[model samples]
Target: MTNVLVLGANGKIAKLATAQLLANPDNHLTLFLRNSKRLANAASDRVKVVEGDAASEADLKAVMADADIVYANLAGSIEAEAKAVVAAMDASGLKRLIWISTLGIYDEVPGNFGKWNHQMLDGGYLETYGAAAKTIEDSDLDYTIIRPAWLSNNDEVAYETTQKGEAFKGTEVSRKSIAALVAKLVADPSQAIHESLGVNKPNTDGDKPAWY
Candidate 1:
């Protein structure tokens, strides 16, 4: 049985991912969140809840103890928190990491959509996420960076995943799909290890629903 620690465990998609993780009889899941109260009643023998800020070194170290893999789902200031997570993982000697990032951090979103993403959500903050990704990528640890296009609340499972160069195509994808992707990463990370992968819902017209 693999013990997996999930950071940002209370987010919408994270919650779904948590469900999938819990469904796995062979996995021990830990839900690390700043406010455990926000999490609906989803805890059991296989699922444990730990309350603490992911950015706090002590808390991260404490929660990461004895874990085989760590799946990061924390949102907001992700770059900084990612750095902290790297440090904590390094300290704990847990070399497996599956991180979630934005699709266009590489500036590869394409055409007007890319321009708008850069103008609106991209901003200068992306440098931080990129740097954070670089830190994990360069480390001796095995890491898989999963970047998602746009997030939505739709309940669907059909979606596509790409490597570094492939375009994300769609404007938005369901959070549930992203969650399923995370669960897959947790299950079979070796295939994507030490690689960066992109994900999105393949669209017919190429023009998709606004992520906003």
Candidate 2:
């Protein structure tokens, strides 16, 4: 059985991934978030919901004992959380990690869109996120950093990926697509190990997302 620990379980993509992971009877899940009450109704024989702070190494270590994989969907103080996660994983001897990040952390977005992306994200968001991604990349743990394009609530799963050094593709991708990618990784942990993927919907390339 694969024991998956989901940090920031209340996030939209994490919730979707949780349902998809649960569809496979052999996969068990530990939903970790700041307030367990938010997921009070999510507990079951195969699901364990725990309250904890992602930035607290002790909190993370407490839940890492049985986890085969760690999927962190977090925001705010992300660098601190990344350090804490790496430390906890190292201490637990757990290796697999799936981290949800944003596009342009590498400044790899190209053309006018790249400029626009920097203009929009440069102030503080990209800096902190970049530091967080760096923290994960520098760790010894096997990790896949997912860099998603502009997100939408679209109810579709059409998306593609670009490697770390490759220019990011398209403009936007649905949250469902990101969730699907996460589920795929959980189902087959061998794929994208130690890789950073830039996810976007095919044929949607532009200076901005269609809705903008």
Candidate 3:
């Protein structure tokens, strides 16, 4: 059985990914978040909901005991959280991490879209997220960093990926697509190790997301 620890379980994409992960009977999940009450109803024999801050290495280590894979979908003070995760995983002798990051962290988006992306994400967001990705990459753990383009709430799961250093494609992608990709990775842990993927919907390229 694959024991998965999902940090930020209350996140929209994490919740979607939880459903997908649970579909595989061999996969067991420990949902970790700051507020356990938020996911009180999701607990089951295969699912364990626990409350804890991702920024606390002690809290993370406690949940890391039985986790074979760590999927982190976090926001706010992300760099500190990343550090805590890495330290805790190292302490627990755990590897294999899947991190959810945002697009434009590498400045690889091209054309007006690239410029527009900076206008939208500059200041603090991109910087801290980039730092977080760096922390994961610098670690000895086998890790896959997922960088998603502008997100939409669309129900569709169609999407594509660009590797690190490649110009990011399209302008937007569905949250469901990201969740699907996360599930795919969990199913095949060896895939995309040490790779950073930029996910987007095909042919949606524009200076900005359609809704913007």
Instruction: Supply candidate 2's per-residue lDDT for 140.
Output: 91
Alpha carbon lDDT of each predicted model: 0.80, 0.96, 0.97
Q: Which scores greater on lDDT, model 1 or model 3?
A: 3
Who wins the TM-score comparison?
3
lDDT of 3 by residue, 109-187 (tens): 9999999999989999999999999999999999999999999999999999999999999999999999999999999
Q: Residue-wise lDDT of candidate 1 within 1-212, one digit each (tens)?
A: 98999899878878888888777889898889988877647677788888998878779999888799898887777666877888888899889988887778787778777777777665566677777777777777788888887778888976887788776576777889988888887888676888888778877214335634
- Identify the runs in model 3 with alpha carbons over 4 angstroms from their true place: none
TM-score of each: 0.91, 0.99, 0.99
Q: Which wins on TM-score, candidate 2 or candidate 3?
A: 3
Model 1 pairs in collision: none
TM-score, cand. 1: 0.91
The collision pairs in model 2 are none
**Candidate 1 — what's its lDDT?**
0.80
What lDDT score goes with residue 71 in model 3? 99
RMSD, candidate 1, Å: 1.9
* Cα distance off (Å), candidate 2, residue 210: 1.0
